[model samples]
Target: MDLSTPPPDLYGRPRADTFFRFLTAFGDRYSPALGGPLLRRNPRRPFSRPTEALQLVVTARRRVAADVVELTLADPSGGPLPGWQPGAHLRLTLPSGRERHYSLCGDPADPADQADPAGSAERSGYRIAVRRLPDGGGGSAEIHDTLHPGTRLTARRPRNGFAFCAEPAVLFLAGGIGITPLLPMVREARRNGLDWHLVHTGRSADTLPFAAELRALDPARVHLRTDDEHGGPPTGTELLAHAPRGAAVYCCGPAPMLTAVQRALDASPAASLHFERFGAAPVTDGEPFTVRLGADGPELPVPADRSALDVLREARPDLPYSCKQGFCGTCEVRLLAGAPDHRDRRLTPERRADGALLPCVSRAAAGETLVLDL
Candidate 1:
């Protein structure tokens, strides 16, 4: 293995590879630099890296769909912004202290390269779209309701778990706002004159953002399917009809749609599927456990259907957590007792051995009781 070339991160972004991968995966407390610090089980602040986060201003905001809004973010100074490839997403820290990931929907090239005769302030910007969820954890709602032009926000570097694969034959499947990441992929495919087709499905035309813009690229290749027009949602088999025998399939959508597409892929074993989910992954084969906030604290029952983070937050509402999927390492707490299942993608074995566990996705063994330093 090439030590210089780190492996893909938890999100699978190839360009996001870094030496930290080695430190996190193999390093112990004795390891130097990133490892020693990372393995510290009881740091005052968990994975705090304020300097790496960019403070950006909202240069523009517009409602692109019924409940989706597109935002253009740029550095406060007129300077070149970081370049990202298709399928990248920004880990945005909202003013309300909530963090949410939004796909980079705009062109990958920095806007600074394009000359604007009118001296528009759109230089060096990254664009993202958010769909307001009435029942979500308040991140999306806060973004839709409060963010506007001139508003400032913090965003980590772009990470792409769903990197685009430039296959000879490509089929893109997008459901509703899931089109954000796939938009740039389609553009890249078109720009390269690759053989590709896109099937965008939604509840209706108004719910799909950039519908007209996508259609304008290639009306014949871009297929728009809506429940209102199509009578009902298409089956997995029906949707797979658009693909060639060995075409690569990229899909981002609601859980049901993703599941359907995945199930259909079993029939066409030659074709591969890549997907990205915006919500917490459902607990699978979970076993019940008991958790204590502190040594002498109250013990709470963790059911199979719910995450420990969800239950713990009800008691301690101020518990910090983001990306309940377990990649952010925000809900990491020192484990005082019990063996953790260790399901998160962020923490390394050494860290876990040092008594650290992410409450968001990590849990104890069946019928086991875990003591956390809440």
Candidate 2:
């Protein structure tokens, strides 16, 4: 079979052959029969400087809600895990050998929250939660179904894209599983005595993860809205009504909720809005284009349906990439020429003007050829 052109699925998306190869590689590297030595082989790419993958054991697992499962990962060596701040997430290499990013929801400062206090060793652990997405990608389902207590997995240290800022006042709006990253932020706010409030919504009370924990922090400041109870979701205007002018607002949720929040804050003066998305920014069909690697490398064609990262990976498999949805800056490349259709949220307007582009989810303009400093 020609690996380049696989049959398109119902959505007309081409299936890359590299996925199968990755699965084979995953098994060879992580197979239990091979033992700890083989698993110790670092999976970090040369380009992913200062970041490396570590082996973690599942010390505990429990269902937090109807479809959500919370996992506690600890270092097998019984040592403290890497330190992280609020709004940080870990990239775990799953059973299928695919990488998935999950937010760290547990308290970073508390050693007991992360480690086994029973042992004499100063052990620490990291806590993360996953919501099963049956109809969506396979990562969440694999975590819920395959991962368990005593299971071993590989994960990268915490990388934070959504860093919490100290302001006069803070308002957080979360929808469904999006609450994972914001939970720690709310805790830090309270610990520091900063005024903060959280407006969380889900399909129903049963589906809201960490409902009790959030309410315990502060009932008056936390607002819970359920579609089943409220007859519909709360509007962004309603959630932001209590926010004072110039307050810092952070939101994470489904696209609709984020869009609504953006619209609500469009007219507010002096308010700073921050967002963290689990998926790529909504993009229309892109036009076919070509990219030149380095100054003299071959000009590779990027299909409209494929990402630049996929095309570049054909020649450079070592290219660092995680969360290919463009939320992560691992696949960022310097643009020497041509206009980029700036689709990634990670790059600021100034960085885009400075010729920075994330190849994972971004594309080129019509009939434009991009020269990359690969």
Candidate 3:
């Protein structure tokens, strides 16, 4: 670790210190400070927990567009789910029995949404933006076709996989549905009076929600790029035009957009680029191996052809999983001893280097005797 400066987080990873301060306010309660009767040991990790389940009751639902559904979920058990920071997401049991993970797009500090009775429930509830997927028989479709107001579901408590940094300003890039998780981070940055810019893209303006909000922000701070604008094509070049140096660029769109951003960021340092994905991916460089679960101590065969999730389920059916695509950290395991070859898209390289493994896509790189947390 470089001693030239203070280390970021415990991972020696770079982090915007203020982000941690903000996270401390969210469901991250500890004794002697946010004094409560509840005894605690885990001390409420923001982006650090494997998973925390919540009972979510859909209080409101609105069709923001043809494919997009905006939903408000509150306490199904009438209690606070957990503390969450911006860029947090929850995986849950949707109305169709299909599990899906949706980013929490609400302000973490908004007391109106807080689960505390003394705190406000008006703005404290979690908001999820779900767009109907053409092939997603699991998440998007269930939220679109089956869910409505009064629908109750079980969800993993909010966990922030994507975190903001303290860089001078931020450049947020959103593609298609990738815009959901980014909304809160943008709002927080703007509210904090941070100097940041946003480059939003979609098929057309009509397909993009928050057009009015984006425009309301100073024109210098926001730019909209639509592929099918009436004036002409949105000019794919416009997407690259806003690439600013020294500014952290976050992209959340389709694979094409992500690829474009990846290539664009190649021109800059790796730390300035961040992106999110909601698709299938192979565990790169994986080889067939065996995993030893801590509880049962059973030897399960994991093949190069099989996903770690698939092998684990066959060995331990009761294992928790949501958004098997790796967005939710429910299946995250602690690497008691092993060189984990991480392939998930959720964690930063520094954190992944710290020995956490998401069984959904990550696998063992060393020998056998992989000890798991659950």
Candidate 4:
């Protein structure tokens, strides 16, 4: 660990000192926090034991696009599954015990869409789409190659990090499988009779998932752009050229696409952007620190370029974590000692004050030791 000087001034990672201040200013500008709709009237449908483990059976599976497979998970006894809204994701534990989080693409209102071909009206399932990532960790590959009908998997209830909010106009930009979370959001926006548009882009039409469904919803409002058809990839500015002024923009895609969209937002301040990345944000401006597990447990050193979760896992490999990005609360632990340089978007001010921190993307200041409830 380097103790030579202070940390780098990375614009990407939020600094602990200014995070709460930024949050208040951001809420004032955005009108509502990114958690969800501020004007929702209907109560969330009843759900039992949201955080408990559920054994779900795969009732149906099919290829929706070139590398994407849509899987329908249902209760074995045909009971109602937990209710969720747009932007919610499921924590799936694969047969090999590797955990992965996938956005809930299917409509929560119609949980068992076509799962019961026999025309049963039971709201017995949830749907998710997975794009096989050969270069990524093995979760996607396992789902693509090994999982099939009748396969049972362990999963946690839905959790929403990239929630859709109420607005007069909405603009959605999706890249490849990043469309999963936005799918339900688009549906909700349209159902509410709100003005909305979608710009779906991918390598080609063959690689874009749910193209037919999108067009079937509204042909004129959906713009499907492909790199092959458009000569090459488009600039972030080009993507927003046709967006409505003062629209709420929701985006999910490759990091380059997101970075481009963020850059475009800088030039076009009329639109407010809310985005969810496919993977963890790259750590930047991090300073090395120490973490002492529990009271007398080992003190582990977290390098400047790495996360505390990554280092702690070496000592406790079974340490639970779903999304390494810190959006999900799976890796959160009690902050027993030291001031944390909080970087996660999941924790609220109340939770932080209650002594909780997500180690996945957060750390301690230089020369300080963060004692966690391992």
Candidate 5:
């Protein structure tokens, strides 16, 4: 029984089925290098997927400015949160235990997207600004008014809904409450030594936070326009009228402001205009529809009268849901079959084409029985 190497038959056996699995993984990463083999092997994989959440307890909370509050979070095991890129957002599940996305405005020195949950203590801290809106009291007010230090809340790993580009020059447009996300981006841009400018539109300097920080950003570069005093909307005639041509324009604010910017940038490079909505997503011409949770199941009726999530809640009050606005992707479910009339703005085009749907507000076409993979 001298079987020093008796397993000669198993040598090539391991390579038979998985002869190219390693190559496949390699080709997947280096797509441009092996684009042919990669696409031919797996053609339908989605470009992006919803993010995952990690439960982080609040270790400390401090007010930095009149509106902005500094919050420190750590892993459930009392370790630091992950390092993230500038303009990245952490999904904060409020005390009411609902989730909302907030931009991190703290140190942008480290950019760790896939940070380890265990050893993230050194890069554990993050900063977010909360402006209490009179009409908005869902979560921001809770963090501002009710929540305190040592409170435990769940946090989704940081995600980049807006990221800076390597363009030679860039223009950042911010309306009243829209500066939160752009704040970090500007800091990071300056750190990277990029040529950038800001157009901040507000009722006045009193209503706008981070005024001094933005003002100190090179007088020749930063422009603060107050409608209450400036007498007009910051527009092509006001803001973009003197915009340096060929710079990427990133705008975020009220729909009206964003639409105006979009219309102006429309004639320019479509690739250069980037926008993100601070409020609910806009999906017009929506019609009533029905969704079947499974095959032969009772088709739940969805009304344009209300959101799909509202209807689902009216039907089953026990179902789990966090954000009804489609930001958290907490209520994510797979589509077993049938095409979905996706209305979410968070997901990319490639993802929607993969039959993904957010049950929150999205609907289905007539005669289309939407199936949920939950």
Candidate 6:
């Protein structure tokens, strides 16, 4: 069967009935009276343990751009840090107890390879850049104002939801600080000698982080377009014009730019596009609903102003959750029944069809009651 094509009985009433019949026949043929081992399945689903939080100290902090700051975090005990691939992000627990996620922008190669043999060569560190969001949430402000060298912080092991695709060629489009996750991907592409091009845009040259570093990487392949110098931002038509046929387009940027890129890629049949959003998923106009955790559990009221995860956590505080913005899949639960509004960006159309829901941001239809596996 073609991997891209869905099976005829992939999802529907027919599939469920067929599965039920198969299970019944199998049980009848392999009974305990036949002297064979009884077929018993585990009741609980296997789940991978969560990544442990690392105690890291800020070793260096520098302003890389007008509002962007680069922070270097190292293990306080001087040990090797966890390895991470391109497009990975670290969830940081701030001093105020607020959890925030930031992408790793530095090189993924072992730092020990280039360090002196006697000077903690085996120890590795992570470099992350953050842009101050004055009018937005307080996480960025906390990092900018209070975090400094010698300050200790806790962060989870790196996890990646956005990953690089293996393609013959790639086109990278970054807007402002969105370039953080794509930085390592560009380096890897260059190291592998892949055909790659980068288009970076910002309000002004001063606002674009890593401007000098990106220019030095490959001036021929890197295109910088600033609103001040170009009269306006580069249009999607101009960006795609440089993308060759069959190339994979990876974009991480402001919502407006991403929306425009999506529209442009929709018109292009030769190139495939992937996106990573730095902000929360677009909110929907939803009404209050009810969520039943288990068959015998009490129904919880989910208010329109609150999330299902928040409501459920009030009663059951052990529920797993991280990055409440819905980008991470930590809070995903099996949907036993109900029509989900499905607002999460992590779940694909096919996965949503498979009865999975991200409770952190997803909701049920108005007046609908959802039954969850929790």
Model 1, 133-197: lDDT tens per residue?
A: 99877888899889999999998888777777677688899999999999988987887677889
Off by over 4 Å in 6: 1-49, 110-123, 284-324, 327-360, 368-374
Score each candidate by Cα lDDT: 0.81, 0.80, 0.68, 0.82, 0.66, 0.79
- RMSD in Å for candidate 2, one decimal? 15.7
* Of candidates 4 and 1, the better by TM-score: 1
- TM-scores of the models, in the given order? 0.84, 0.69, 0.65, 0.74, 0.69, 0.71
Please identify model 2 stretches exceeding 4 Å from their true place: 1-49, 114-123, 268-270, 284-322, 327-359, 368-374
Name the lDDT value of residue 28 in candidate 5. Answer: 62
**Candidate 2, residues 1-374: lDDT per residue as tens digits?**
12135333221233447788688668655756334455533345333356568789999999998999999999887777766767888888876776788998987655466455453222388889999988754788888889999899998777777777656589988999999999988988888777788988999999999999999999999988899998898787877775766788989998888888888886653288999887765555978999999878789998877888889988887676767787667778999988888878689787888988999888987678999998
- Candidate that would win on TM-score: 1
> Which pairs clash inside model 6?
none
* Reference-based lDDT, residue 236, model 2: 76
lDDT (Cα) of model 1: 0.81
Task: TM-score for candidate 4, please give it.
Answer: 0.74
Summarize candidate 6's per-residue lDDT along 58-162 as a digit string, tens digits. Answer: 999999999899999988987777666668788888777767789989876534432334543233788999999987557889899999999999988777777
Task: List model 5 lDDT by residue over 255-347, tens digit each.
Answer: 889878877775653237776777665556667777777766677777666566666666666555654667566666677887787767567
**Comparing 4 and 5 by TM-score, which wins?**
4
Q: Could you list the CA RMSD of all candidates, in the order they appear?
A: 6.1, 15.7, 9.3, 11.6, 11.4, 9.2
Candidate 3 has an lDDT of: 0.68
Total clashing residue pairs per candidate? 1, 2, 9, 0, 2, 0
Q: Model 3, range 251-369, lDDT digits (tens) per residue?
A: 77776667666665655533467767766554556678778777468777788767777788777776666766765566777776666667676786766767678888877654555
As for lDDT, the candidate ahead, 4 or 6, is 4
